[model samples]
Target: MKKRSIIGLTMGGLMLIAALCTKAVTPTLRLSDTRPKIILGTAIPTKFGDWQEDASQVAAVVNPTTVAELNKIYAETLSRTYVNRQGNRIMLSIAYGTDQRDNLSVHFPEGCYGGQGFAVGQTSQVVLPTVAGGIATSRTVATLNSRVEPITYWVVVGDKAVPNSWEVKKVKLAYALQGMIPDATLMRVSSIGEDIEQGYQLQQSFIDQLLQSMPPDLRGHFSGTSH
Candidate 1:
C-alpha cells in the first residue's frame, strides 16, 4: 500500500510539473504591443489623382441604419464621395477594426446591402492587378428600384488582402497562433450606373489612381502590401 501511495504521489507531482511547464510555453492569445494601429482618416488621402472629395454627397450612398450598425463594429469609419473631371463619381467607404475577433469582424457589403433592401447580384471574387501585385477582392452589383451600384472591395486581415471568410479566418488564426490579435480594414469603392462593367472599370481606375497618388507608406493600408 505504501509503495502504491509513493507511486501515485510521484505521478501527481510529474503531472503538476508538466502542467506548469505547459503554462509557461503555451502562448496566450492576447493582443501584442508590437502591432501598429492604423488610423483610417489619416491613412487615406482625401484628394488623390483626379478624384476630389464631394463632402455634400456623403449621405447619399449609405443610410442611417447601416451607419448605426457600422458605428458599433468599426473603431473608425470613413465615408467619402469622390468625383473626377469626367463627371464620374465613386463612393469610398473604409471601416477599420483594431480587434478582428469573430465577434468584431467586419460587416461585409453583401449583408449590409441586403439589410438596406438592396438586391445583391453578380457576386464574384476577382484578383485586382495593382502596382504591388494582384490583390484579391470581391465585386457585386446591388440594385434598388432605379439605382444600380457596382462595388469592388477587399478586406485586409493583418497585412494580407483576404478574399473571403475562409481566408479571413485563416489569416486571423495565423496571427493568433503567434500570440497576436490582428487588425482588419474593409476598403470598399462603388459607383452608381446601369452598366455594371463600366462601373467596375471606373472603380478600378479610381483605386489604381488613388493608390498611385498616395505616399508609399500609406498605400499598404488600402492595397494590403508594402509596395
Candidate 2:
C-alpha cells in the first residue's frame, strides 16, 4: 500500500475506535436509582443525641450556594442549625445531586465566600471521626468583617469519600467509564467563632455524636464507609 494511504487508513480506524468507545461507555444509569429514594428531611435527623434543631438560628446560617446555583446543582439541599443543651450552635449544610456528570459536581465554599467579600484561608486536611474509624475531609476558615467561621466539610463521590477535588473527578470518571452516573453529596459543618482550633474540635464532636445517633447503615451512607 502507498504510505499516504496507509496513514489515512490508520487515522480512520483510530477515529472509529474512539467513537465506539465513547458510545460504549456513555453513562445511562444513575447509581442513585439502585438505592432507596433519598429524602434529606429524614435521612438526617432533626434531633440527634443532645443536640436539637433550632429554628431560630437556622435563618442565621447562610448557605454558600445562592438560590439559582442551589437549584441548578442539588436535587435537595438541607441547611439547619443545631443547638446543644449548653446553647452551643453548629450550622450544618448538605447538598446532594442525583446526577453528577462531568459538566457539574458541587460548589466550593471558597468561591462563594470570595464572591461575598469574605477572606478564605488555606484549606487543611482533616479526618472526621466515624464508626469506620475516620473519614478524610477538609477544613478552612472564612472571615467577613468581625465574624469568623470555621468549616469542616467532605465530598462523597458515589460510595467513596474522596480526599480532594482531583480525587472527586477521578472517581466520577471511573464511574462514567463503567457506564454509571454516580450521585454526589457535599456536607459542610461550621461554627462562627474566633478560636479556630476550638471550633474544629466542637465540629468534630458534633459529627461523632450525629453519626453515633444513626443506624450503622445510615452511618456508612453519611461517611461513605462500608461499615
Candidate 3:
C-alpha cells in the first residue's frame, strides 16, 4: 500500500507540473495593443495607376454580413469600387481585426457569398509578384443568375500573408506559441463578369498597381516584408 501511494503521488505531481507549465506558456500578450493600427480608408488609395474610385458604383459593393456581426468581429472594414481607364470596375472589400483568437476570424468571402445565394466555384491558388516578393492568394468564382463574380483575396497575420482560410488558424497558432496574439487583415477584390480569366487579369493588374502605390511600410503590412 505504501509503494502504491508513492507512485500515485508522483503521477499527480507530474500532472500538476505539466498543467502549470502549459498555463505559464499560454499566450497572454496581444500584439494588437502595441502594433500600429491599420486605417483601411487611407491605407488603400482612391486613385492609383490608371484606376480611380468609381464613386457611383461604391453603393453596389455591399457586404452580405450584417453591421452588428461586422462590428463584433472586425476592427475596421472598407468597401469600394474602382474603375480603370478601360472602364473595367473592380469591387474591393477589406476587413481588419485586432484579435483573431476565438470567434473573431475574418469572415471569408466564400461563406459570405454562400449566404447570399451564390453558387461558389472551386477556389484556385495564385501567387502575386510584389516588390516584397510573391504573395500567395486565392481566387474563386461566385455565380448567381446572370451575375458572375470572380474574387481574389489573401489574409495577413502579423507580418505573414496567407491565402488559404485554414492556414490563417495555423498562423494564429504560431503567433500564440510565441506568446503574442497577431492581428489579421482580409483583402478581397472581385469583378462582375462571365469571362473569369479576363476578370482575374484585371484584378491582378489592379492589385499590383495598388500595392506599388502604397508606401513601402504600408505595402509590407499586406504582402509581408521579407524579400
Best by TM-score: 2
TM-score of each: 0.83, 0.92, 0.90
56 Cα displacement, candidate 1 (Å): 1.4
lDDT of 3 by residue, 98-171 (tens): 98886788888889999989999998898987666789899999999999999999998888889887888788
For residues 153-185, could you state the per-residue lDDT of candidate 1 as single tens digits? 899877889777788988887777676777788
**lDDT: which is higher, 1 or 3?**
3
Per-residue lDDT value at 195 in model 3: 93
- TM-score-sorted candidate list, best first: 2, 3, 1
Query: Where does model 2 exceed 4 Å of error?
Result: 1-7
The TM-score, computed over Cα atoms with residue i paired to residue i, of candidate 3 is 0.90
| Worst ten in a row by lDDT for model 2 | 218-227
Candidate 1: TM-score? 0.83
- lDDT values of the candidates? 0.82, 0.86, 0.87
Clashing residue pairs, candidate 2? none
Per-residue alpha-carbon lDDT of candidate 2 for residues 95-191, written as tens digits (9 for 90 to 100): 8999998666887777777888989999988777765568889999999999999998888888888767888989888998889999988888999
* Candidate 1 local Cα displacement, residue 171, angstroms: 0.7
